[model samples]
Target: MYDVVIIGAGPHALSLLSRMLINTPDKYEERPDNKSLFFKNKSGVYKTKVKDNPQTRNTPRQLSTYLRKGGVIDENVLNNICVIDRHGGWMTQWSKQFDALGISHLRSTSSIHPDAFDLHTLVQFAEDHRREGELLEIDGGIRGSKFTGPFIVPSLGLFWDFCKSVVKRHKLEDFVTKGFVTRLLPKDGGYDVCLASGDVIVAKQVVVATGNIGVKRIPGWARDVYDGCVDGSLLHTWDIINNSDATGIHTSDVCKQMVKLNMRNPINNTGNTVVIVGGGLSSAHLVVKAAMSGADQIHLVCRSSIKVRQFDLELEWIGRSRFIKLADFYSMKSFEKRSHVVRSSRGGGSITPYVHQQLVKLQESGRLIIHEDTEVWECNKDENHWSIQLSNGHMVDCYIIWLATGSIVDVTMNPLFCDVIKELPINIIDDLPVLTDDLEWGCGSGLYVMGALGGLVLGPDALNLAGARGGASRIAHRLKC
Candidate 1:
């Protein structure tokens, strides 16, 4: 069995692997029968640590010696740690996703390194790979399985060579790269991990570092709406990502096709109105994307006027610069008392300056309309189009409607843990895992959760990239037990 098995090849898994290797136990020649040298777990075992026996410590000591000789680490503790990207190619998927969207820049400034693994000490290890050759490099992507054995270190091939060169230049050889992890299950002693290809690995201690890739929470309302609109012309963001012919069309072309599909049929010039519902960043992006795609008239609808308040100084400045109207209905006195509650309950902010500038230009040209303090009461479809009723007593006649609503954590979407989570003895908070402070799910011992799935446990920041790093670090520290 392997010492650790991390699920999902995303950044979270990579970070955890790096931490595990860095904190791995080292053998010493001074002590022969020391079992309690490292930290103990709840069961009073000394966890996983190397012994200090002269004969047994030779290999580990030699490895450490080699590392020290190469200037990889000054001490043995640093040598034990290994950190590498779970994916053979670093940031390949993320970079592609961004490139497809024509997003040369990020909506938020993220603190991530080129490798995407975010541990300070582990990064240092990868920077010094030339001096220490102990770190093994694996290349095969993980396939799915339930079997577990000693951690299988796959061959790195050319990828390993590139990583080795990077480590040598950066002095980070202590970080080893093992390809993606596909599936994980608890075993008799520790855990069994299955790879994407069908390889089985057994480890004494396993860490499931699968990030949010496999988990998708389609909100209840969204699911209902998606089902209802399937026959009509409605498309979700997920659908767009999954169904689009990426190579065949540009981003604008995809958006235009989506808009056309949403319209259901050829729309008359006077009938081609679009309504986008939501108050979040995605909604704002949709507005601009739709406008760019040649929507004649666009209407943005939100439940409360708080949408305006969610804007930051930068966004507010953009709003002023663009002259976009702000709408809120609550009495000023009542708003003063409920502002804190509103901020806490209502999630997400509005448009960014970059988007706001574009939106303002559109509005100036009389292309966009904003409707605030309105809730969608009901939507009735006719043979020709849809008629939407708002709580504000206004009626919207449109050829297409786009629900840019947010997501919810639904375990049903994840086939791997669907049955397992259902059988576990734990409380599901807000339909999400009720994790402990360490981010471990209440039902499983070794299995931990991060990313959007842990939203109930981590609050608003749960799905963010930085949040994944924080959750991974917390889970790693707990595993040291």
Candidate 2:
């Protein structure tokens, strides 16, 4: 039996793995006068190495080497850990989503990444690779917060390369098993992780790091119409990325619809119109893609006006104010109240200011239309096109209907945890489970959760890149303790 089994191999899993290694005591002894090579400036920011000691500059390189094959960590500790993913690869789903949606860069800052050893690891990697230009500054830096300086975001390509480097550096490939965990059966102070292929792995502890799977939220109309049918003309953004076949878009091939839409003739010379439903960043990306693909007109239908912001939430949650807010959040006894705060803080689907500006430019060019305060009242699909009626009394007949609607993170819907929950029932608020301060299930259960499902404790940024670091740190500390 393994000491620990991580359920998903996404960024969160990588973060947890890195953090666990950080917490694990090194096998090699260090100098007696060992001290931190890096130090913070008067402004309390941890920059590069101290200039006084030129030897200290190698500290970052030492830390980087720490994860290599012949690193300081004990081999037994690494051998005891097991990680599994459905795709059997690191960052498979995460990279797929980025490529499918054509996202240019990350929404979170550069410092917020999977590396748990140092916050500036990603920045340092960018500098090391001489791809500093890929680290674009966040439109507006955290102005009033102590987290000042250039709020940089890494390009998707750069981030992908960095993650690959992390996997290589950590030598994590040997620890990962390729399988889909179907069930988690807790017994005898441990759990049996059942995979889809009739294989089972027993572990003393389990970490459910699966990103938003089995939580696709569909609109009432779309559900009634499609009824789980894999229609080529209509597919959710998550569905397209996760299951490329659902929309006739093969993963290995460029989106077939783009070419088809560009070549298809317009109905009654009105041009090839496409309707995208939602106002989130994904929806905006789709709008821009369709517009660039020569779609005559694109309609963005939102139930409310588009909420534009630099990040998912205000800068406060990500800046130094998060500690105070988290303290207040933890103090509240009611899980329901905490849930309300999370929902309010997230608000709903929102687009970034940069993407919003792109949409506006497309609108001005008459290639895009924004329909705010409207919903898809009705939808009728034919062999040729889709006829949709908006709540605001506008009728749209388009060649394709893309749903950029966000997903729902319901822990109850997760099949792997169904048996575990039944065995040890825990308090759940609005589909989010109440975990211990260490993010573990109560009663000394070794099962732990990370990602959006852990929002009740991690706060609003629970699903973002930053949350990975926070969640991983908690779980790793608990395991080490």
Each candidate's clash count = 42, 0
Candidate 1 structure lDDT: 0.46
Taking the tens digit of each residue's C-alpha lDDT, what string does model 2 give over 154-214? 8998999988877776777656689999999999979999999999999999999998884
Superposed by TM-score, candidate 1 places the C-alpha of residue 360 at a distance from the truth, in angstroms, of 2.9
Give a tens-digit lDDT track for model 1, residues 156-255: 2322343343344334444445554455565565555655667666654444444445333344444565576754345544444344454545333324
Candidate 1 Cα errors over 4 Å, as ranges: 18-104, 110-185, 190-225, 246-265, 270-272, 306-349, 397-399, 410-414, 422-424, 442-444, 455-459, 477-481
Count backbone clashes in candidate 2: 0
Model 1: worst 10 consecutive residues (lDDT sum)? 322-331
- Best of the candidates, lDDT: 2
How accurate locally is residue 464 in candidate 2, as Cα lDDT from 0 to 100?
79
